[model samples]
Target: MPRETPRSSRVGSRIQRVLGQVISADIRDSRLGLSTVTDVEVTKDLSAARVYISALGDREAAGQAVEVLNERAPYLRHRVAQAMSLRHTPSLRFMPDYSQADSDRIRSLLNSGPAGEADNKE
Candidate 1:
């Protein structure tokens, strides 16, 4: 049986949804071009949230995107608070989500390298 989702997790999901919309439509900064809100991880106490962002660019550009988001975190948090009725909105912290790039690299490596060549030697 699937475990019940905690309140913090539920809140985090809501935050992620709000952020996705807010970042896409509300904020129109050129530095954040093609950036997406990938995930939101809320602390157990729900005091703060780490928002993961996947940006369309190289590492430096991605880092700049994150910096731009972090700079506007207060506004983003307020946007989330407006969307949600939580008594206290968690502080938002923008972070670069590198999992996508890492997975792509791993996939390329696996595809380019031989698969278990030593295993066939018996």
Candidate 2:
């Protein structure tokens, strides 16, 4: 028999999906330029969640998007509750996911003349 998925993991995935749909289809804020829910981390008690958001625009715009999302978290929570049959919807705290930025920084460093000063010396 296969192992069962953890409850927290299930809730996190569901929250990620619901928030993505709500933001894309329901919210109409321009600051949210091409934003998507990258991931979600839900507490074991399922009382709260940290929703990671990613966007395709300037950092300022993405930051504004996170602010907007956080401000509308209650409404989003209601929407999620309506969509799911959970007794308690996780409280959403929107945060800007720095995954892309970090990856880009790493890539730039990697592409910047080999790897170390030793290589440039040779």
lDDT of 1 by residue, 27-87 (tens): 8888887888888888877788888998876666678889999999889888898999988
Candidate no. 1 TM-score: 0.83
By summed lDDT, the worst window of 10 consecutive residues in model 2 runs over 1-10
lDDT of 2 by residue, 33-117 (tens): 8888998888888888889887875577669889999999999999999999998888889889878867877888888766577
Per-model TM values vs. the true structure: 0.83, 0.83
- Model 1 residue 69 CA deviation (Å) reads 0.4
Off-target runs (Cα >4 Å) in candidate 2 are 1-5, 114-122
Evaluate model 2: give its lDDT.
Answer: 0.84
The local lDDT score (0 to 100) that residue 55 gets in candidate 2 is: 80
What do the candidate models score in CA lDDT, each in turn?
0.84, 0.84
Clashing pairs in model 2, backbone N/Cα/C closer than 3 A: none
